[model samples]
Target: MIPGVSINEILTLTSILFFIGVYGFITRKNLISILISVELILNTSVINFVVINKYLYPELLQGMLYSIFIIAVAAAETALAVAIIINIYRRTGSVAVRETETMKH
Candidate 1:
């Protein structure tokens, strides 16, 4: 939509963001960091959906609807995740992935 930007460029950007999110998710040992990584991953997908829909089917609202649904789900998931993390922190006193392993009991 910009003067020179193309869908390919947008998709490439999203792809890079996706991999960065994946890397963060894989290497992060803290619950908060993992949650942030997951959010980043979800955001990239949302962007992809919207961009593809806008470029290929500008007449339809399906992509926009789907993205709205995704955003709602992501919000709910984040709330639940934060609540769980807080509970775990209160119980174990640490949010580190390795340190919270005692929760199995």
Candidate 2:
């Protein structure tokens, strides 16, 4: 146990968040919503890394480093995704997934 929180409790919360992200990704039709879900999934992973590292190996900075790297990657991913989505919206006039099936000439 670390301070007031247990590993099991942290794992459970992360699991729930991960599932919620998955559900959002699967159910949402909008491109922005899908991006949001992806971010949520990434965030949950970061949380898991931090919690596990804190409890299992408090002396090493590996988890924190990995989490920082993940955050950087997530930032880049979101920037690229948003740019693409914006371009798609500009061309199609909507950000819904269904609207992307047809190719524009």
TM-score of 2: 0.93
Per-residue lDDT tens digits for candidate 1, residues 1-105, read 456889999999999999999999999999999999999999999999999898889998899899999999999999999999999999989999999885566
lDDT of 2 by residue, 1-105 (tens): 468888999999999999999999999999999999999999999999999899889899899899999999999999999999999889999999998867657
10 residues in a row with least lDDT, candidate 2: 96-105
Report the Cα lDDT for candidate 1. Answer: 0.95
- TM-score for each model: 0.94, 0.93
Stretches > 4 Å off in candidate 2 = 103-105
lDDT of 1 at 20: 97
What total of clashing residue pairs does each candidate reach?
0, 0
lDDT of each: 0.95, 0.95
